[model samples]
Target: MAGVHVVANQKGGVGKTTVTVNLAAVVADTLGGTADSSPVLGVSTDPQASMLEWAERAGNELPFDFEQCHDNPKLLGKLREIKQYSHIFVDTPGSLENESILQAVLTQADDVIVPLEPEPLSFNPATRSIERVIQPAGVPWRVLLNNWDPRDGTADLEQTREYIAAKRWPAFNTVIRHYKLHTRAPADGVTVVQYAKNRVALEARQDFFRLALEVLGTGGDGPRHASAVNGVSSTNGG
Candidate 1:
């Protein structure tokens, strides 16, 4: 069976869909997937169907398979049964009211990637989702620092890391910096790998490539001692 990775967070606007699609794309590319036979699959359980829309906009250019299974717990739970794909990346609903949808996908998650913006307000809800939903599921999960701007210096980034450490939460060493290319991706129907070959685009794709290596267990040291808190070992990546 394929490894099922669900990108989830209870709070909205954390780049869950962006993480799902791009991570899947980079992993698929790394694995040498083709349009005809993709090793990766991207599934969206969000009512907004953002992933599906993005895929449609990209037309036949996406490197992996894509699907939207909104409000369908049975389909979501059965994803692990699919054997063709090496990995299945799921984009889930963002609101607490969609707890049922989130719960359904978590049932199949081998690992969960929770994208967190480095801001004070995003802290509580992220912790809430981890404590109430992800931790209870007992899956090895990590908090990914997304949308961080290095131009703003490392204070906010360092503070976010401190918060995660104080709570003993697992996290990726890979911080996905803020890039206008990422914001323009969905509208342009492109993934990081499909971005124009410019320095900025290269940097954008490199982040996800490093992240994909980590997710595939081929990069970086594993996450901090998060096993002590959740009793599940966390994996690290570059």
Candidate 2:
């Protein structure tokens, strides 16, 4: 089977869209060359459509094009019907109530990446979202830390880590540093690969590649049963 990875969190401004778009680009680069690579299909479900906008600004020349699914109740069924593509990346809305669309996607999804800001508020939503949608629908997920600053040991990083540890949740070990480059990332409308080789973007790219490997799984035959979508999917094949 094919994989569907949702970049979402109940809370807003956790860099959901940024992660979605860039992650898609990284996946493309990692697996795009070989015909056997599992292709990634990026779906923009958020009302704001930040990922969609980035796709537009980056021009239609990307390895994979981002599709706007409109968050209709029919979304999941619509996606599953097309199995030619290999993977799916969905950028969901920020509000918790958006579960209607999120849950529908998750029902068919294999995994999700919940971006947390290393704070209690960011930490809280993963559990709630899982309880409400992930567990209910039987989907797997990983919490990814974003905008991390180790300086705030007492309030941000440590607290969130302990909370996640207590809950026994899966989280990415790579931490995205808080940098002006990352803040300006979306405006540039490209993944770290497309940017200048600064230290910050370089690290971000490596971390994202780690996430891509996690998505693609070990030994990279790349997820089985690639989706039936129209184009060559964006994949992170080994």
Candidate 3:
């Protein structure tokens, strides 16, 4: 059966939809090759149907197969039975008001990607969601550091890492820095793999590809422990 990956977080604006769209493109770029069709399927369960809207704008240019299953988590079972793709990515709701739908998706997912913003306001809600919702469901999850800024040294990054470390949450080493291309991607109705032809876009492409590898447990060391710094695991577990 194809693996179901859910991009989730209870907090809004953490880039869950962005991660879902780009990562789907990354998977399609690799799995689909130059044949012009992808084995990856992008599913959207968000009430707003953001991924569907993006696909509509992208029209026939989207790399992977796209579908809208808004508020319908059961479609996952049927999709798995079809086994038509190398992997499936589901974009989920970011607000607590949609907790039931989010929980339903998480319960059916093979893995979860929690996009965490490196800031004060995001810490508690992300931690709570991971602990109360994800952990209890026994779903394997990794937190992707989104909107990271590495210019002024590693102080803020280190602090956020420490907080995650204290909670003992698993995370990826690839940090997604804020970029104009990422901000412009959704509005442009394209993903980095298709639209990232320039400097920042190229860098963003590499970031998501690295993230895709990590999620597949083929990025050298797999998902690292929260104490991992520069891909070197500081703790015993990974």
Highest-scoring model, TM-score = 1
Residues 81-181, candidate 1: write the lDDT tens digits: 99988899999999998998988888888888899999999999998999899888887788999999889999998999999889888787788989999
Q: What is the lDDT of residue 183 in candidate 3?
A: 78
Residues 1-238 of candidate 3 have per-residue lDDT tens digits of 7778889898888998899999888988877544355788889888888788888888778888887886456785465565677788889887888878777777667778899988878898898788778777666677888988667567777888888777777778889887778878777878878764677678878999988888777774553334344354522111
The per-prediction tally of clashing pairs is: 2, 13, 0
Clashing pairs in 3: none
lDDT of 1: 0.88
* lDDT digits (tens) for residues 1-238 of candidate 2: 4456777787889888878877777777776723244376778877777777777777645556568875566766566566756767788888876667787777666667788888776666667776676656655566778878655554677788787777766666656656666678667766555778777668667767876776666523233221212232333332
List per-candidate RMSD values in Å: 2.3, 7.1, 4.0
Candidate 3 segments whose C-alpha is farther than 4 A from its true place? 33-36, 77-79, 151-153, 223-238
Error of 3 at 163 (Å): 0.5
For model 1 the local lDDT of residue 193 reads 92
The predicted structure with the larger TM-score, 1 or 3, is 1
Q: Looking at model 2, report the run of 10 residues with the lowest lDDT sum.
A: 221-230
Error of 2 at 48 (Å): 1.6
